[model samples]
Target chain A: MRNIKLTIEYDGKRYLGWQRLGDSEKTIQGKIESVIEQMTNEKIEIIGSGRTDAGAHAKGQAANFKTNSEMARNEMLAFFNRYLPGDIVVKKVEEMPERFHARYNVKGKQYSYYVWNDPIPTAFERYHSFYFPQTLDMDKMTAACEKLIGKHDFAGFSALKKTKKSTTRTIDDISIEREGSMLHFTFVGDGFLHKMVRILMGTILEIGAGKLELIVIDEIFETKVRENAGETVPAHGLFLDEVYY
Target chain B: MRNIKLTIEYDGKRYLGWQRLGDSEKTIQGKIESVIEQMTNEKIEIIGSGRTDAGAHAKGQAANFKTNSEMARNEMLAFFNRYLPGDIVVKKVEEMPERFHARYNVKGKQYSYYVWNDPIPTAFERYHSFYFPQTLDMDKMTAACEKLIGKHDFAGFSALKKTKKSTTRTIDDISIEREGSMLHFTFVGDGFLHKMVRILMGTILEIGAGKLELIVIDEIFETKVRENAGETVPAHGLFLDEVYY
Candidate 1:
């Protein structure tokens, strides 16, 4: 059996997300698997690095599947592009080692969220950005980002109530920058919990707006309470930028 | 009567461009007019600089309408933003001279066309750019662009079959530049004929691909035959970048 690693990019505006739901073709994984089934003529199960929430985009999402078909890499790539919807694209496909697994071998990930800071709504970026439509105090937001960088239990920042598994994760870096009328927040970490990035963005926005004090992040970190963080931001602004192995 | 000039921006993916058609609410002009009518409680006519084809976008389109309402500029701006679709925005509004017409007083205009040059389709920019998977020779395209500049009769470059008016037009400047995997073509001229920008892009693309000779532009200018130039590119890739008065 040959293991094929696929680099996927998708606009999740109309998709449920990266994971396959039973008997439903509305998800990104389901769409790709359907195309692969037609190409390989076999029922194959593909493993994704992780799942992104509904309406969350991905640029360099990784996945792997075992197929007995001997199709070349370029041929498979072309076939996938031809069959897949315009919003979802298989950027690259490569033959992986027999022991290689997409989900089990994931090392790190990077996510970026865009907040449109203009008072007037942006015509072109209506679908991709969170239209905050308010002035954001970047200095304070940047300070909050600095405080967020480190290994910590992010349970307070996630959507989960209580976790059986450890919520301790290492955030290698966090950067807040402005591009024109948009505020960009980039996070690189070992792993992220459910709705963790969105919650973090919400808290930062709240801090920027002076609705919450800068110390709220520290309070949430110490208390490990979900309600301490700000409300969860929309999923549309978030992007799974890169997945590393 | 106070004439309010509006600088408009819209994503033309859904609308029928910037012109109003019989009872159709899909046009950008129609949407603005309806909002203006509601604001003033009077049926008013709004004039645009020119008509952009259906599915064509605009960033700096200019329009003007007469109204007796003494609404402040900021108030009007806020009102327009609140009423207009999320894909459309009134960027600026200013009181203009009574005689200043949006169409008649136009001095120069600028339009831009975006071509995605990568093999893999862009996830974010899919709606904004034309996905041209084929390789484009920028040097050859630039050479073609250089030949296109100057005062010339652009009848052959337009989509119009017959015209009583003068087809003589002056192309002030043309710039072809690359930003990452996207090729941007900007054209500045006193005025453009129907589909003239799109036709020019198509011819330049052909020249870049070695499908047409560099001298075809000169040939089209000399012949003044509509069939001499290349095909018109899609409207989705074209944008009315700026309207100068």
Candidate 2:
């Protein structure tokens, strides 16, 4: 069997998420697998690096699958692109070593969230960004980002509950900057729990809007309570930028 | 009657152009008039700077309408933004002098067109740009732009039928540059004839792709025949960037 790595990009507006569910055709994984099955005439399952929430987009979602079919990498990429919907594109395909796994071999991930910090929402960015009507203080938000870097248990910023798996993740860096009319937040970390990036964005935005204080980050980290954090922003604003190996 | 001006931004994917045609309500002008009538309880019509083609977007399309209602400018702006669909946004509302006219007062206009020049089309830019998989020579495209600057008879570049109106227009500038993976074309002119920018883009791209020679621009201008020009690009990639008065 040949181990192949696939880099995927998708507009996740119409799909459920990156994971497959029982008898549901709305998942991105299911859609890709179905297309691959048609090309190879074999049952195949692709392992994604991680799952993105519904309505969240991906610029570079990494996945890997082992296949018995003797097809060239270029041919497979073309076949997949031809069969997949316009919203999903297989960017690149390469043969990897037999030991490579998309899910278990991940070293880091980078995510970005866009907030349109303006009173009037832009028509072009309506689907790609979150429209926040209230004015946000960049100074406050910049200050709040200081508390997020480094290794810490970010259970309070996530939606996971009573999990036996460890919730401690090492956040390497966090950057907040304005991109034209939108505020862009980028995170580089080893891994993130469910809704962690969004929750962090919501809390940072609230702090910028003066609804929360700087000390709230410390409090949430200490308490490890999901309710202690701020709102979970809409999924459309989040993007899985890249999955590292 | 008090005259007020509005600056609008729209996605244009769902609109049937900017002009109101007969009884059709799919136009951007018709939509705004309907919303204004509902708010003021009086029928109103807006005169736009010009008509944008169907499926073409706008960043700052200007329009003006007269109303007897003494609604505050800020209130009117808020009302339009609230009632309008998410794809149509009213960015600014101001009380203009009674002599101000959207169409007649235009001193200049700016338009931009985007072309995705890459092998893999990005899923996000599918609707916003025209995807040309072939590589292009920027030097060739830039050379073609020089022939387009200044005043000339653009009859061959337009879609106008036999008419008494002057086919000559002064082009102040034309710029072609790369913006990330996309090629951006900008035109600043006294005014543009129907489908002039798109047709110019089509001709210029052909030159870049080596499909058509640069001397064809001269032949088209000298002969003033529409059939001598290259293909007219799609409307979705065109945008009315600004209308200067």
Candidate 3:
């Protein structure tokens, strides 16, 4: 058996996310798993590095599945591209070691959020980006980012009410960039909890818009309560950028 | 009375070009005109700079209409952006001179074409760009562009069956640039016949792919026949970038 790793890119506008839910065809994982089952003639399960939410896009999502078929890497890649929808593309296929796993072996991940900080929304990018119709103070947002760049319990920033697992995670960097009327937020971290990035975006944008004070970051960190954080920004603006092994 | 000059941008994926046909509401012009009429309580015709084909996007499509309503420019702009569909946006609304017209007073136009020069199509931009699997020779395409520049009768490169008006047009420049797996084609010209840019793109890409020789451009110019030229690329990749007055 060979452990095949896949790097996938998808526009997740219509997908229910990267996990199969019963037998719904609107999920990214369901669609790919069904295609793989058809190709291999066996029940197969694909392990994603992270399960992104519905409507969130991915540029380099990593996944892995074990197979016994003796097909070339390029052929399997082409087969997936041919069978999958146009919005979901398997960018690369690699035969990994037997012990290689998609989720358990993950080292780090990168995520990006797009915000259109203009009075009006853009026509083409409205679906892919969040339209924040308020002027953002970059300095205020940058100050807020500084408060979150370290190992901390981000439980307050997650949408999950409670989890038994450890909520502490290491965030190596958080960069904020402005290009014209678009604000790009990049998050590099070891792992993120459910809705962590969206809530973080909401908290930072609220700070920049003067709705919340910079000290709210400290309050959230200390409280570790979901209600203490800002609202979760829409899923469409979020992107699973990359997964590193 | 006010003569309003509006700059518009739209994702033409669901639009039937920019012209109204009968009572169909699928056209961009029809949608905007109805919205304007709803706001002003009067029927008004929108004159677009060019009648783009179905699925052709526009970044800066110039249009104008005469109105007797006493609404301010900003108010009208906001109203249009509010009422029109999310895919269509009125970027700017200006009260122009009495004699200003969208079509007749145009000085020059700029168009852009996007080609994904790779084997697999991009998931995000599949609708906005053309996927070409063939490897393109940038030097050959650039040389073909040079042969077609300046004053020339581009009648052979049009999709129109026949036109009584002269097909002579001035092409100021055509630049081809490659960035990674994407090719960007920019065309600047005083005027263009119907489907001229699409045809020009197809011809040049064919030349770059070694399917057509460099002399084919000169032969098409002399022959003045639509059949003498290469195929017309799809309408989705074409973009009306700007209309300069």
* Model 3 chain A: ten consecutive residues of lowest lDDT: A223-232
Return the candidate ranking by lDDT, descending. Answer: 3, 2, 1
lDDT of 1 by residue, B107-207 (tens): 99999999998878887777778888787788889899888888899999998878799998899899988889898999999999999999999999988
Q: Which model scores highest in DockQ?
A: 3
lDDT of 3 by residue, A106-192 (tens): 999999999998886799888789999988888999999999999999999997777799999999999988898888999999999
lDDT of 3 at A139: 93
Top candidate, metric TM-score: 3
Q: List the residue pairs that clash in candidate 3.
A: none
Candidate 2 lDDT over A1-245, as tens digits, reads: 89989999999999999999985489999999999899889899999999999999999999999889998888988898888988999999989999999999999999999999887888899888999989888898888888888889998999987888999999998898787788889999999999999999999999999999999999988998888778999999999999999
- Fnat, one value per model: 0.70, 0.75, 0.73
- Tell me model 2's lDDT, rounded to 2 decimals: 0.92
- For every model shown, the clashing-pair count is 0, 0, 0
Indicate the residue-level lDDT of A73 in model 2: 85
- lDDT per residue for candidate 1 within A53-89, as digits (tens), equals 9999998999999999998999999899899988999
Q: Which pairs clash inside model 1?
A: none
Query: Model 2 interface RMSD, in angstroms?
Result: 0.7
For model 3, the superposed segments whose C-alpha errors exceed 4 Å read none
